[model samples]
Target: MTLPTTEDRDPQSIGLSAKPDEEVLAHILQRQIVALEAARDAMPQIAGAAAALHAAAASGGKIGYAGAGSAGLTALTDCLELPGTFGFPADRMRILYAGGAKNLMTLAGVHEDDSEAGFKDFQESGLGSRDVLIAVSASGTTPYTLSAVQAANDAGTETIGIANNADTPLLREATHAVLLKTPAEVIAGSTRLGAASAQKAALNMMSTLVALRLGHAVRGHMVNLVADNEKLRLRAQRILQDLTGCTPDDAAIALQNAGGRVKTAALMLLKNLDVDTADRTLALHDGNLRPFL
Candidate 1:
């Protein structure tokens, strides 16, 4: 039987068990570099997916991520970080794991094949044409992930699929397929290594680009980050100080006047506007700071 590329054994690791520690580490590092290169080659597809996601966000639609096993965990991490990293609204995001949210803490492998569960989760979540769903599966044939894609399609949702194989069902079914096409893992079928690395890189590209398109990022800085903690509050102050030629103390005052909103505070400092005017300006500009600068 012909094995999938992800399942094939790598010749470099044939004697991995007997190799020295440094040599084994080097071998794994080499494969990781290859995985990153594969992901880089897929950037065109990732950019397209980002554009689709930006459209969905503009329409007030939620972004959903669905997957199984390691891929699911990676997708979940990306989904959860959006709110804090780019100030993407938490309510506008959803994560569909094979066994549900609780399974995130204790991964149960059996749920990876539960298609009915996938269908039901998407149904209950109310995914529709306005929403964008990103489905990830290293094998590109996980029944749970495919079922989620099918559900999203049935609801007229834009679906972006990320997989480590070519011509697989996950890629074939998705509206935009991002194929990483990385080589086999050092540990053979244990896809959590190389496959997961490629998937992570692809997702990072897609979500970060989407954030840039959404105006959450400005000049390589996260202008819309929520300053709910001390470290972030300090960072917000620094952002305003650097951008507006204000002292840290002045930035702190601006932050307070803007009610702890980093974007609004920066707007106030840069435009020399009062809190109310800066807030209004941000709202008028759709939360983007580039035009004001």
Candidate 2:
């Protein structure tokens, strides 16, 4: 059964900051409790999604986040960065927003209730049993998110629903459900404030920590990053030089041998192996190039 909307929270205790003006303080006092509680409440559902995603990746499947509005934006941010930062393939992750890619930059509101659109997106992506789907909505009633979740379930893909309201419809249908517990906005019902922040935090936990647990991070660094650009190229050089005491010039050449892969370059320098050896070793051990080096 769905829980009650808002989950009956106090809007005071959430704002713990003591160093703000009266106006700001009052605003915090009026909404802090509910705002944070909203995020706190969703932890369980987020945990489920994370677990499913980790399992899916381990089994050669993918993880996807679907939503509209702020939730969709945050998911997109996480998905696009998966490759450049952690070196996951584009197919390993996806963020399906209600509006198409064209609407990502424009402020035009997507049709939140477009169930058919959600189904089509899920279908086009070939949702399957190996995948995990995360559906986000502050109100717990966005039709697009709901449709996607339902489609994922039908395809045997695990599904997690995130919402601010308790006992929400989406929650009831999803395999796992978590409530954010955010109440009406400080300005009334504007969920963009607390709800959005809560969603970001939960998503951060899912992607960043999942990456870490799955060996995407090394010594707290994005070592498996794809060094395909000027900024990332420099980052690869710095990482290589820092790890192996190589000169800038030597690091640059090593990076080339490693095909501009920071982690691979570091492995080559540290292990004193050729690029081919480093590549083979890292591929053997799930890209933990540093340890292999």
Give the number of the best model, judged by TM-score: 1
Q: Tell me the TM-score of each prediction against the true structure.
A: 0.97, 0.84
Residues 1-293 of candidate 2: C-alpha lDDT, one tens digit per residue: 63344433335434545546786767765565556665566676677777877788768787788988777776677778777777777877777789778777783665677999999899987668988888888878889989999889989988878787777788898887877766655544556667777777777787777778777776677877878889988888887777789999989999988898877788778888898888888788876654553
Give me candidate 1's TM-score against the actual structure. 0.97
Regions of candidate 1 where Cα sits further than 4 Å from its true position: none
Candidate 2 global lDDT: 0.76
Task: Report the alpha-carbon TM-score of model 2 versus the true structure.
Answer: 0.84
Q: Write the per-residue lDDT of candidate 1 for residues 181-252, one digit (tens) a residue.
A: 899898988888988998888888877887888788877788889788899999898888777789989999
Among these predictions, the greatest lDDT belongs to 1
Instruction: Assess the local accuracy of residue 94 in candidate 2 as a C-alpha lDDT between 0 and 100.
Output: 72
